[model samples]
Target chain A: MVKEQIKPMTSRERVLAGLRREPVDRTPVCNPTSVATVELMDLVDAHFPEANRNPEMMARLAATGYTEIGFDSIMPVFSIIQESSALGCKMQWEQKDNWPTVRMREPIWRDVEDVVIPNDFLTHPDTACVIECIKILKKEYGDDVAIIGKTMGPWTLGYHCFGVEPFLLMSLDDPGKTKLALERMKEATIQFGMAQIEAGADALTVPDHATGDLVSGEYYDRYLKDMHAEFVDLLPVPLILHICGRTVDRMNSIAETGIAAFHFDSKNKPQESMDIIEDRISLVGNINNPETLYAKGPDAVRDEVCANLDAGVHMVGPECAIPLQTAIENLTAIPNAVKEWHSRRESH
Target chain B: MADLQDISNEKIRQEIEEFVENPDEIERNIETFARVRPLMQEIAAALIEGDDGTVDALTKQALEDKIDALEIMDDGLIAAMGVVGIKFRDNYIFVPEVLACARAMKAGMAYIEPILSASGVEPLATVIMGMVKGDLHDIGKNLCIMMLRGSGFNVVDLGVDTSDDEFIDAVEEHSAPILGMSALLTTTMPNMGKTIEAFIDADMRDDVKIMVGGAPVTQEFADDMGADAYGKDALECVAVAKGFLSVQA
Candidate 1:
């Protein structure tokens, strides 16, 4: 079958079109999560702890996804602990080579009533940095590329504020209380999401860590599906829900959420994930980070990019946050392979 | 699902029969629960359902009824977890479900441990487990600990972000012959090899059998790290520990 000739899209048009499941010249190489590596940080002189807390540095480091690696989108929220930091969880700001994490053992909230979005939640330095980074990227890139901002979903915040064990135990011990806790915590997500949108984010990745390894699909249905749908209505920009690990079980429910897309994990086969979502929501993902990108070479990376394209994944990128030391060549290979795949398809 | 309160032995056996769609897949020793006394089967069912209260209360009742603690543990709690492990490995359940089952197993173990210890029988074997240094993720390690304990191994859970010194100290302190290390990040994964090298430097490499696991760990990575075995999940963690114990025996 001969394919019609297609025109090339600007990064912004390509990414937004892919998210909307609209036809694009080719699949956009997008990382809704962090593509910030120690190498990228060094190149930009914007290492973490500072890159995570300073807007200019954050933007500089994040810009490499577009500038250096050539992904269609630049995502600045490199760490998931921003809202948690703003909301009072103690932050373990690690060195340049490590991703910062919330110190969950020192949980800040004990119950639903204690789930407070601090007075300066959005204005807090860490959270503010994300918004400021988005603003900077928007001013700099404008319509040339899609600037994707991230807001932590409440389930993930529950782990940060309440402690992973305490929050999970609460969910198992009392589903009703877990529901109420997530309901209250979701305000932080909305508040942060709206701030990013106001700062000129074209899309927001609502990363709820209902990871397939840790939480059941049934738990997702009970706690997060409705909340995510509410996020679509509440957050102004295109919403891409990112959940890590094998998530095919919840793809149907995730598809029904009316979100713009789901950034999937490498554990899920791209074709099977496509068959499950069935174009209900566009899929953006799922190149293996640890094995393929972090450990292997560009050839292995291309193989995954081809797999995602073959499966009709709407966009293609690393599964989650790429490791801090991931090779530059391996990272760049994503967009290169996507373009090559498109060119080959057109030639056929 | 049948009402959890319907705790009769026959009903519990029927529940196990129902919960375990493929009985043949369970270990041969665990499959013997099918022929055990009804109360034991009921205990197994409560544990499988993750009803810690039911498992705890029924375990005490089984003790009061003079059932052997070992019999209760082997045929009841461990048997139930055997099914839970298979279900988890097969993707019929997930972390939350496995965690719930582990909690129930712990509750039943709380009643069984003292009696088993008093009976003067040595633990099945001693194993030390921890998440490698710089990696704080322990959900996988904790799950393996729970499954190891449930499967009759005395597990020394060194917890998350454990350094090589901590691992060596725990092994030396506990005199554990088997060591299990877990890491969730590729960056911290090399620390497992570092820990093994530390063991070699300390001249304790042959003193313990080493197993490695976590989301990012592959058999190739395990071999590269000089680990004796690599478990893909909590179930495989238990199986590897069992294999280590059998080899030592």
Candidate 2:
């Protein structure tokens, strides 16, 4: 294998190089979702539901990804609810230990016509929190660590605003109406996405839960592909598109969308995922969240990291969002494993 | 095997074909119906078709006509649900389809509950179920509850964010043989272990067998948490619940 003898890169340079699928000194560790842990919350004095709403707390907690754990990028938006909350959906911002969820059971919008991008969508405290968090991270760690921001995709926004059942039923019962809803909803994606970019995010992790089990490959082709491709033009930043669950079926369709990378889940095997995308876009993630990281020790965590690096995934990190109570040593094992694997290769 | 396409009642067959997507699963569903009485076949077909009103009406009329409620439940709702479970497990169908089937089964079970209770026809087992503390996700948990009920287990659902004491309290109150915990988020999964430790602390761990499941849960995690059983989906949850009953028996 031809290896680069380039000088060592900063975490920011490595991440941006990874996004561009360029050669870096080593593979950059980028978690397009989150890596927040309760232990980290205690260390940084940034706790959830509040960290999700407070820009400084959010930035402090997010910086632990780079500052404490040595991830190549610092992702400030830990939760998926910021856009949903700002859009007027009711929220269940649970205790400090739990994830703040949208009250999706009580959907805010029933029809496309009922949907409104309130003038305050961006400036609303929840939305502003994310923008402000990115700005703070950029100000503090701008030159050293990649500040990756997150924006919810229209499909996920559809689930929050219309509720999961009604939205899935809509997709099944009326394709035209679902398309209309997605088209109307895509604006929100571009809106928050551009807002974060303007706030100085090196790239964006747009989590659209068009997940594998609920939606199909054909569904991706029909509903999300063009919109994602359109996002490439609109967001004007390298997008690490994230969809959870076993998503091997849609990787081919996703590769055609012009996004920079696919932030995939552990449910997908790293080797099979790499083969599916055919290197059309950068691939990141595959470390298991629940079993390998949360439940097991660092050895198990290192094994998964090594597997993803071996599969030639461009960047590596937890597949979905970090489970909040996951142990600290398990989190650090991610970058530790990545560096070890590359070092062994260099020795050869 | 003669083709499932050979079955009469194109209405029921078409419904089965639409909702039961895999060819092998479609054949199995046809055989489940073909082997049962015509009335039971009608009920099973209605359940698969997710026509809760039809299941409700058919169940009510069958009981009025003196058809054994057990036959209607076993031959009808449970049999149909087995197919729904298979389709969902196999990824040939998804949440919407399974939910419709669950509601259809619930509609049928509504009639069976009173008859079984009044006749002293004991349920499969009383099972305590809940989402672990700090995890509000319940789509998978709700689906498992419906499946357990369809399979004749009387389940007491504690809803989401259930504290550890609540799980022990439910088990003791109901004298249940099985307890199932679910958590969709990885962060909240440790609560399953914490709840198990709570049972051990209360000195009631021996009273009820524990089973854990959810989206991110796996057999290895379940074992690590010291759970007696782990189910990947709602279908498997029923099997695990039954397995727990046999272990107690």
Candidate 3:
């Protein structure tokens, strides 16, 4: 145990440093998805819907997360709708600063046979903006700040293209159809993932909704188990898997995914989840974003962060993308908590 | 050994037949603290077989037989689900099977709810549930609704991406005693508190209890927001809601 003195580093260095398993001066506070706020929308003039898709505006607004809150990284893309938009789902582009949502009433694919990964999918503006944002961040910060990119998993793509109710029903009635859908969508996952890796993204977050509500751990094994393992093989950089809900059920399988880490939810106990992962991969978070970061103040954020830090996650962050209205002080408290934890550990 | 084995076999056969013919009776007995493990296995099979009509018929019989809904949830279905949930917790079962059981439970509930509603079973309390603004994640919110309903509360689900004004409107519309707010994203979680503040501004905070849950929430944070309760999962939400409603009584 060669303990060394720690110092402040840039967000890019802090994140990349952690990925490499090197000692970081302090924990990096970065979300691989947008932490866009309504305040940022007014500041950068890059509101949602477009901020979710446009490169320049997206970068400008995302930068606020880094500039204003002192997070180690900036994420441009706001929602998982991009992959579905490319996959041909009917989209409702809401107001500026609002993420576009897929209209489930109008599913693009009624059946698995209708699913296809378009050849020019990566070149789509929604996809291209992410790449452009990465480039903009790289050029602007020049290795000072980490640029996080995001891609949708095949399951999330399945939700957008096939619709939530339809997709769940297909999985129930015809397992074969569900497999077929996930398989065809795998190419989209790979294509977008590779493009982001090629761009200046320090890491990429793959958020799939393998929740306890809609599906079981068996579904993760039947579908996502191997697919996630394949993602570890395909992507060149560190990959983080973010799933919503009480995913303690799938923790063991998720630990086996061979990705760099798993970003978990607060519904999961930090100590219990830690015991499950057991150092198989770096753990990112289980912060109570709604109750702590969103509803409460910075002091509450600090309390939750210390709990996760004490539980031994590799990084500390909001459990997921933060609410648009979360106060800046609350977001900054994550890093502050990390720093306080480090100091406390040293004194002990 | 042979005599014990023969007796066990006879018991099992009789239990299986009863489970197949009278699942509702088994559920009702379970409410009275009678063990329904064998019957639960039978119901699980019926569910996996997708015998919707059989499940419906059995559910109706259970209501007729006076099976306590909450007891059925705890002793029969959720108990079976506990098996699935444990396997899921262990990675032995995956998303598909869990979803299947959830569907089966939902199917059973659909049959049971109308009966429970008609029985004029007064809810322990009325809870208005919703997701706050700038968030579309409802899976957690939906789970809490099921647990709240199962625990004997009448829940008014306002659905996802709800604004402060909408929550205020629901509180007035339903005249509910408790409010449960949920958000999956850190970004939307604070809106839960702001929504609470809105209630305060409208002078409606005194009349209602506020409970918050989701992937991003914490109890300490709930306290900071002046929320009455904080639930970690859907099951916990039921316990918390029950506690609050009981306190009021």
Candidate 4:
């Protein structure tokens, strides 16, 4: 039994309390998404390009998300290249300051017939590193700060695996072939997801780019709805479904998928997004990353935090994986704003 | 075989249209590619042969047949993407299709760049672009550069992890009026503000309009940082650049 009059203690405590939907003394400033900071890059000696691929370095930088920056969770494997890299796509490892990207000039799976998830997929160095990082975090932090693991959704992986152009062509040319490719990619999603869960991750962020960008809400309903629902059912832990870009159009269906929470983007306003998906799901965001978190000062970060708290978001965070260069002062101010808001509310 | 010849031109035309409306179709249907290859080769031959009227008629027929402008880049692929961008903004198309069209446009652009440069057509604006200091994320930056180039801006890409001095010097050398800064991380985003402050301290604020973007940026933050604009993404950056130039006019 919990007392209604209890006040929030710390960000860690506030987040755990919120996981149960219990009334916290204040809002929690947990980034269930990536919180890569430059300080961490130097601290770990594993910067971008390498951290974007190598598991050991990936874990080190991810650890800074919790140990160094005071974020409530550590998210390893920052980029979305695992499935594509494993699927044999050519990657351009630009340099330290740039995250590695799939070179789309030559897509791996030229045709639907060529698409297949590798058998030794789990043992792949990058995939193995993500699982290892989660396991290591679980061992180190135990249950103190949640360890959020990322497994690219099959659709997103499909974008990199077959090259965006080839995949889109298959989607239009032969719908069945596109379905075939997605079906194969799902094995990678499920296998990686289960591995992370087994590796001691408290939660898993299933990032499927089901934005209104390339695919329609109808596409999500038709392809991902059932798979996501099943993932939630089988995973046996909180699943945070993160989709980039404006996704308000699919709030109804996303809520219906039984995900514990939806990590949203700034493209959708916090109040409007909350109004749309409040009761159906636990809303986690609406902070404008580019304008507020990335470009402004701590003052602006605090303002956005208070606004999100006012909008009744179950959790407040950056709209997405925060850029590596975001000011630490802006991020550290998140917890402070939540605390001030609660204190003001209590006094009133 | 007789029907193949009877409808060869029509078949090539239809294939070209599918290639235009959906660039993905060009990769999937090998037969369509084979059929169109000869016609495209003939058009290239005609262009080489100096048969202007024949090339014009074939190009128009190809377009009517639904030839993607990208496939006919020596023809006018930019016009096709312009159509795609309009359709995209109007909600008639989606991201994947737009991406496909962009790819097609890129392919065509590759073929046309040298020729276009030789024609002495000046770009609308000269823009300096880069990912801000301490941030390595470049998707948003690259996309903006592509869009800027597509929209007729002479883009000087400074690559990722650029320091304030690098930006100031680039502006000095290129005489660029717009400095587009991007940061994908919250930590790096503040660098945008710092960079803008550098420009101001150098008394270059009046000379350049600073535009900031990436996942974490907002318009309010841009205003707070004294940046001229905050583009939500690459597309918005184009509109902002165009608007800024218009204001100059």
Candidate 5:
């Protein structure tokens, strides 16, 4: 059978096409998570603690994903703690080489009734920087590349707001209250997602840490499935859901969420994840960040990239955020391998 | 095959039937379950189901019913956690389920600990556990602590973001023979190695066995850092602790 040859797409077009499950010239290297590293930060003089706060530095560091590494998408929101920081959780804004984290020991809210999205939530420096950064990327790239924005899901917000032990314990001790808390917290997700969309983000990465290691597939169905479907309807842009660890157990439920795609972790096999999604939604990744991208060389990175391509992953990127110390060569090899694999496929 | 009716306890029989209906491919430590008495099996089944209230009640009833504290621990809590460990490793269950099981195990342990300690019977081993410096994630370490305690080890938990000196001081204070470190981020994984180097510099390298685990840790990384062992999950953490104890013996 003769397959039709498609024309190459612009970075924005390529990523959108891949998300829509349409044909592309090659697989788009889309990192819905951060690819910012210590080396890249030094290259652009945009380090964390500041990049996390300043829009100019955030956009500059994120642009390296496209300009330096040749990925089709640029993700500016590096830390998951931005929304939490704005919500009043104590944040440890680490050095250039470290990831900023929320101090879970100091939880801000005790009950679902206490959950309140401050009037200044959108105008907060940390949250506003993401919107402003997306605006800057749109000005510079202007439809040439896809600018991806992130909004922490309610489950992640629960971790930041109530602390991990208290939240999980609440989920186990009293599911009704947990649902109410997630229901109330979801408003924050929708507001931030809409703000980024208005700020010119083409897509949104919704990272809810219902990681397979921490939460069960049943919990995904019970708590998050409806909310995720709601996000697709409420948010204007395409939504990519990201979860870490072996999530094959919940892939079936995730497929029914009406999301545009799922950014999977390396703990899951690429072929298995592809099969589970069954083309219902695009699968963006299953790359090993710690092993292949951080510890091993480019050759190992190429092998994983090829594996995802062969598995028919809609886009290729790291499993989660790449380690801050990950080499530039390993990050560059992702797009290079995608191009080479497409060329080889075409030749055959 | 044993008859379901002949198994005596309905809950234990139901649990076995459930496993029989959908069997896991991983080889379980069935010897522990097989050696458990019928009452202990019921306790084990409740623990596996994560019925903490039931575990708490059953453990108390067993103690009052004249069951040996050590017998109830080995035959009930530890045995149940063994099934959970394999289920988790093989992906039959996940973190929420495991946490439930660990909580139930703790419910059972609360009644057993004081009794076992008062009898002057030695613990399986004294171990120190913590999250490496700069890493705040401790869910994995907490799970390991639960499993270690269930398996009869006395663990000194140093909590999250523990510095090298904190780890060294914990081991010294407890006079612990084993140390287990956890880190969720690759950025902080080197802290495990740094903690090991600190031990060496303090001339305490040979005094304690070091083990490392977490999402980012691999056997190769553990070996590179000169760790005595690497556990892939909470169940493996218990096994590694036992291996250290056997070597010391």
Candidate 6:
């Protein structure tokens, strides 16, 4: 544990301990989501949308989170559409300047009966790319740092496969049908998550995307709370639940989830989120992605890091994927702030 | 006697509050609807209920009964949409609910658009809106368009991956005074500045007011690009466009 450390801790040990809500030498500098940037891609010669499909480029690019940005964890999966791609959702593999997104306009499945997990779901290029990247990172940096992996939760999968408008309409119009579709779709989340763990991920970021923009807190409790609790039970390793937007309304329900940590957004204040969660789960993230990391300088980034540290947030990083154009100085500011924070306290 | 006297007011309160959860929004909506005629109030209620077919039928009925088109537009469609916008901003509802309300408002507007055009009733303002180049996310842009059209702005959508030249030409063609840019990616946000630069190069920057928005956009970034205003979301975009026109007027 960090409080009684006789020797210095490894990045991976610090992160795992933080997830367990155990003592840490300091708050771990980590992001369970994408920290990929256009500059980082240029540094590694690993640009997207190719890097998203190619395992070698993916691993190389992900390693920079450690070697370059000084994050305690390396997350290879940047976009949320890998498993959706494997599941045969229409894809728009955008240029290097844009994120590759699911062609949500062209939905694949409509009815609960139409939900199908392919027999070769794990072997398809997109899903398999993630697995291969994890294997490479584990072989290389597994001992040194945590290789975080991503798997789309069923609610997000429902959006990708069923289209956003149609899926939400289904949820609103027919509760039973929507629940059945989510039930049928959850296997894909589990299979892909397990495959990455088998390939040696120390933790998994299961991005459910029960976004606060569309879904209500009541809907989150009604639809995803039990499912997320089940995911914690099924996925053996440490689990992180990521939901975007102003999700403070669902914090109580989220705390009910047996997840190891909640990868929260910057919209929620860190101290308030810690109060709501009250040690039910570890908290990760909440540095503003758009303004602070992408547009502002290192000083702004440092201020955000210090706020999360002050709030006793377990891990600190960008609220979501860093915009591909984020400056290296802003990305590097994270760990530097954490180190400075600990040293300043010790001096006091 | 007091209880009986407040009965009608209380009913209107409960009815509007049924759709609107926020207290401030309900009071504002109640005040806006108070002067509206009963037939127009019926139309507003249907629009707020997201009953597109009912809005369609009732709007057509109001038209046949020789009610003024602008009155229906303002008291019925626009007033209800104001409530929808407030509810959305307050998290009382979200994208799907707003989409439904926009659809209902559209149904009512369909009957009014032809009449308004024939009578030469001017739009609030002509605003040009588009997603910046390389940013394909359209949910935010489409939502803004819906709210703009509902709020009586004549919006010319330039669609996703909009080039600076496209923006420049649209302004010249439409003689539009307001230009709005949206980008959902950080990599593409700089393109907002680039488009503004294109306007400057074309010597048309002063002719049109510029507003920028999306998930990743901010007021500081908008200021950096020398934009006239920045909106955080769809409803706010309507307010920004209105502000631009109000300033122009």
Q: Among these predicted structures, which one has the highest TM-score?
A: 1
Q: Give the TM-score of candidate 1.
A: 0.94
Candidates 1 onward: DockQ, in order: 0.50, 0.49, 0.26, 0.26, 0.53, 0.52
Write candidate 6's Cα lDDT for B1-249 as tens digits.
122223234434555656567666655676677777777877877776788999999999999999999999988888878877777877778777777777788899888999999999888888899988877667788888988887888999998788999999999999999999998777789999999999999999999999999876889989998898999988788878888767421
Sort by DockQ, best first: what order? 5, 6, 1, 2, 3, 4
* Fraction of native A-B contacts kept, per candidate: 0.40, 0.47, 0.40, 0.49, 0.47, 0.49
Models, CA RMSD each: 3.3, 3.3, 6.7, 9.6, 2.9, 2.9
Worst lDDT run of 10 residues, candidate 3 chain A, spans A1-10
How does residue B9 of candidate 6 score in lDDT?
A: 41
Candidate 4 residues B87-197, lDDT tens each? 555455565555555555554455456655776777787999998885654655776777778778889999877999999999989999998999865556667888988
Which segments of model 6 are wrong by more than 4 Å? B1-12, B15-28, B118-120, B247-249
lDDT of candidate 4 over A101-123, digit per residue (tens): 67664567776677787887888
In candidate 1, stretches whose alpha carbon ends up further than 4 angstroms from where it belongs are A1-5, B1-8, B21-23, B26-31, B247-249
Task: Please give the distance, in angstroms, between residue A316's alpha carbon in candidate 2 and its true position after superposition.
Answer: 1.3
Across residues A272-333, which tens digit of lDDT does each residue of candidate 1 receive?
99999888889989998878888789999999999999888999999999988899999999
TM-score of each: 0.94, 0.91, 0.72, 0.70, 0.93, 0.93
Give the winner by TM-score: 4 or 5: 5
- Backbone N/Cα/C clashes per model: 0, 0, 29, 30, 0, 1
Q: Between candidates 2 and 5, which one is better according to DockQ? A: 5
Report residue B27 deviation for candidate 4 (angstroms): 38
Model 3 ranges off by over 4 Å: A1-11, A25-27, A90-100, A104-106, A212-215, A267-280, A297-300, A303-312, A337-348, B1-50, B56-249
lDDT of 3 by residue, B7-86 (tens): 22233334333432345534433342234544444554454444545555665566577777655555545444433333
Docking band of candidate 1: medium
